[model samples]
Target: MADPQSSQLPEDELTVPRAPLNKMIKELLPNVRVANDARELILNCCTEFIQLVSSEANDICNKQAKKTISPEHALQALDSLGFGDYLQECKSVLEECKTVAAKKRKASTRLENLGIPEEELLRQQQELFEKARQEQAAIEQQEWLQLQAAQAAQAQQQGLHLQPGMQPTAATGGHFQPYQVAEGIPQHGAVPSLNQPSSGAGQLPTESASNQQIPPS
Candidate 1:
C-alpha cells in the first residue's frame, strides 16, 4: 500500500494557494463551448501572452472597483478554467452584473466608513437639551414671580401696622382689623385717644388769642 504520508498531495499542490484561479475557474464555468472559445483566443494571440486581467481591461469593460480584482479578470479566470467553453457571451453578462454589484458594495463601504449618522443624532440631542433648558428657565421664572408676590404681601403687612389709624387697612381690603380695646375703638397709632368724648378735659386747652386778658366766654 502507498504510504499515507508520502501519498498525500505532492509538493506542488501543498502550498495552500488562496484563490487558486486555475482550479476555481474550471469549477466556476462548466460549459464546454465557452472553454473552447477561450482556449482558441489564447492560442491565437500574439507572442505576448497577455491574459486580460489588468485594471485597464476591467475599466474598459466598466467594472466597478469593489474587489481588488477586475470583473474582466474574473471572466478571464473563468474562461481559463476548463469551463471557458460554456461562457462566451454569458461571461460578459456575468462581468457586468458583478460590476454593478461591486459598485453598490463600494458605496455601502463608503457610508460605513463615515461615522454613523451623527447629524440626525446630534439634532435630536440638541432638541432635548433645548427643551430641558426651556423648562428649567420657565420654572425659574415662575419661582421668581412667586417670590416677588410673597415680598409684596409681606411689605403690605408691615406697612399696615405702621400707619396712623388702627382702622381696617386698605391693603387687606378691611378683611383683617387691629384688635380693639372697646366697641368703637382705635387699637394703635395717634388716631384718637379721641374715641372718648370731649368732656372738660377732652378739648384742647387754648390761651387767649390777643395779649390782653380775654373775658370768660
Candidate 2:
C-alpha cells in the first residue's frame, strides 16, 4: 500500500477548488455562461469572497474565545457583513447546509434510525448535500444581481460627480463617508462641558439704560 502521509494534502491546499467554483457559478447563473476570462474573474471573486467571509468568521471565533471555526461563526459573519438585503437568502442557504451536515452526522452515528442500508443512506446524504450547494449558489447569484442594481441606482441618483480618487459606495446603507475636521474648528452642535468655566463667566449682567439713568432724566 502507498504511504498515508504521501497521499495526504497540505493544509494550505484546503481551500475550495476551481471545478466546484465553476459549478457554483453555473448554478447561480444558469443561462448566462461564463467564457475563459469570465471564469478567471469568477475564480478571483470567489477567492476574495472566501477570504472576507473567513476573516469575519475568525473575528466571531475570537469573540467567543474559541480556536475552531464553526457553522455558527460563519453564519454570524454572513449576517454581520454588509449583505443586509440578501440576509434572507444567505440565511436559507446556511440553514440548508446545516441540515445536510446534520443528516450526514445522524446517518453515520445513528445506525438504529437508518431504515435503509449504509450505502443507500450515504448516497442519499450526498445527493442532499449537492442540492443544498446548488441552492446556495443560486441564492448568491441573486444577491449579487440585487447588489449591482442597487449600486447602479445609487450612482444614478447621486449623479456620480464625486471628487477624484473617491469612488461611490455601495448602496447597502452600511457605507460611511469620511469627514475631515479643520484644525481649530469644533464639531457642529457639540455640547460644552458644564464643569469647565466659560470665558464670560464670573461677570454680572449689565443694568438696562432706563434703570441706570438718574431720576431727573
Candidate 3:
C-alpha cells in the first residue's frame, strides 16, 4: 500500500517532471561523463556539432535550445572555463575567440566586396558603353570634317591652272608635295589657264610641280 499522505494530490494539481544534471551529462556524453568544466566543454562541443548538422539554424532547434538553455547559463559555463574577469585564463580564451571571430567577419566582408552586385555592375557597364559610343561619334565627326576640308582643297587646285608662284600659296595638306614653279612667273594672284599658251612657254624651263595623289577607289 502506498503512503496515503504522500500520494494524495489536489484535484486541480498537475504532475511535475524532474531532471538531474549528472544524469543529463552522462546521457549527453555517452561514456565520458564528468561533473565539471570538462562536462561544460563536452556540452559546448555537442552544441557545435548540432549546429553543424543543422547546416543552418532551424526554427525548431532554436526554439528548443532557447527554451532549455538560457544565455546566462551558457555564459556561466564559459565563466567556469576561466574566461573573462573571473579568471586570467578565461580572458585569454575570450580574446582568442574575439580575434578569430573578427578575422572571419573580415574575410566575409572581403568576399562581398569582391562580388559584383547585379544592378550596380550592369549600370556601370551600360554607362561605359554609352561613353564609348559618344567617343566613337566624336571621332567620326572629326574624320568627316577633315574629309570635307581635303575635298575642298583638291577642288580649288583643280579649278585653275595656277603656276605655284603665280598665286599667293594656299596651305596644302601636310602630305601635299609642293610643285616648283619659276620664281619670275606672273604674279597678281590669278593663274593663266592650262590651255592658254604661256608668254614664255619653254623659254626658261621651270621645274614642274608634283603632287602626291591618293589612289582612286
Candidate 3, pairs of clashing residues: 82-90, 83-90, 84-90, 179-209
Q: Give the worst 10-residue stretch by lDDT in candidate 1.
A: 46-55
- Give the whole-model CA lDDT for all candidates, comma-separated: 0.58, 0.73, 0.57
Which residue runs of candidate 3 sit more than 4 Å off their true CA positions?
A: 1-116, 160-217
Per residue, candidate 1 scores C-alpha lDDT tens digits across 32-148 of: 334656654444341122333232344434444444555555566556554476567767788798899999999888867876696876898899999999999999999999999
lDDT of 3: 0.57
lDDT tens per residue, model 3, 139-213: 999999999999889877764445443443456523334456576574457676676545555654434524545
| Candidate achieving the largest TM-score | 2
Alpha-carbon RMSD of each model: 20.2, 31.2, 22.0
Spell out the clash pairs found in candidate 2: none
Model 3 earns a TM-score of 0.24
Model 1 misplaced regions, further than 4 Å: 1-116, 160-217
Residue-pair clashes per prediction, in order, are 10, 0, 4
Candidate 2, poorest ten consecutive residues by summed lDDT: 1-10
What TM-score do all the candidates reach, one by one? 0.24, 0.40, 0.24
- Residue 149 C-alpha lDDT in model 3: 91
